[model samples]
Target: DAGVTQSPTHLIKTRGQHVTLRCSPISGHKSVSWYQQVLGQGPQFIFQYYEKEERGRGNFPDRFSARQFPNYSSELNVNALLLGDSALYLCASSFSERPPYFGPGTRLTVL
Candidate 1:
């Protein structure tokens, strides 16, 4: 099966702008996904969604939001972007509560 894939591998935006990152999980290994990552630190749990429902969220601000599609793909949307938002946004897929399979991250840079 194909591995998780993310779109717009690299992105650049300005402060106060909004951005969206997309991810497609591996086939047949759906039902759950979590997203988070930085350049230097370990992965941070941003959000978890299963069956198109949001199951968990991390300490991120309201400007950050995400949703899973019926196809099990997901999108992370960030509004009012800040330089602090510049980082590698990762997506992972898993079954039930199992550990996730991470995707190549989408790098976002806020100018």
Candidate 2:
């Protein structure tokens, strides 16, 4: 079976620098979600997109946002990032609202 995939296993940035993470959902999947996992913490939902439209979002600042493409691929954009924003960004996919299968994630480090 096809599996969810994410890019750049690691990233490092400054306190005010911006970052972008990418992901590709499994074949036949229509929904993609973004999550943030800080060191030693569970993943936190950031956004969910289905059919190229945002379906859900978590409690994140305006600096965090994401979008899903027609092909079920996605991009997470973070702007004016803060040190607190440093975390592992994960991408997940599911056929329904049930628990999703996740990617290995892009670890973001902010100085």
Candidate 3:
């Protein structure tokens, strides 16, 4: 079986722009989560959705949002991108609340 998958392996944007990152979970998975990894730092949990509903959220601002689909794939949208927002966006999936399998992540660079 395949692990989680993400799209647009890399992206470049300017400050104040908006961006959307995508993810597809492994087969039979129903929960998806998003994380932000800044250089030299561990991934910071951003959101977790189960059964297409939001179950948890992190300390990020309202500019960050996400949604899980019926098929369990998910998308993370960030508005008003900032230089500080440049990071690797990772997606993880699991059957339940247990540890999740993470995707390679979408690297975003803000100028």
Per-model RMSD to reference: 1.1, 0.9, 0.6
User: On a 0 to 1 TM-score scale, where does candidate 2 land against the true structure?
Assistant: 0.96
Worst 10 residues of 3 by lDDT: 92-101
Model 3, span 4-111: residue lDDT tens: 999989999999999999999999889999999999999999999999999999999999999988888999999999999999999999987789999999999999
Give the number of the best model, judged by lDDT.
3
Best by TM-score: 3
**For residues 1-111, what per-residue lDDT tens digits would candidate 1 score against the true structure?**
788898889999999999999999888766555556667888888998888999889999999999999899999999999989888999998877788899888989999
Once superposed on the true structure, which residue ranges of model 3 sit more than 4 Å away at CA?
none
**Inter-residue clash pairs, candidate 1:** none
**In model 2, where do residues sit more than 4 Å from their true spots?**
none
Q: Give the TM-score of candidate 1.
A: 0.94
Candidate 2 lDDT, 1-111, residue by residue in tens: 768889989999998888989999988889999999999999999999999999999999999889888898999999998889889999999887777899999999989
Model 1 spans with C-alpha error above 4 angstroms: none
**Whole-model lDDT values for every prediction:** 0.86, 0.92, 0.95
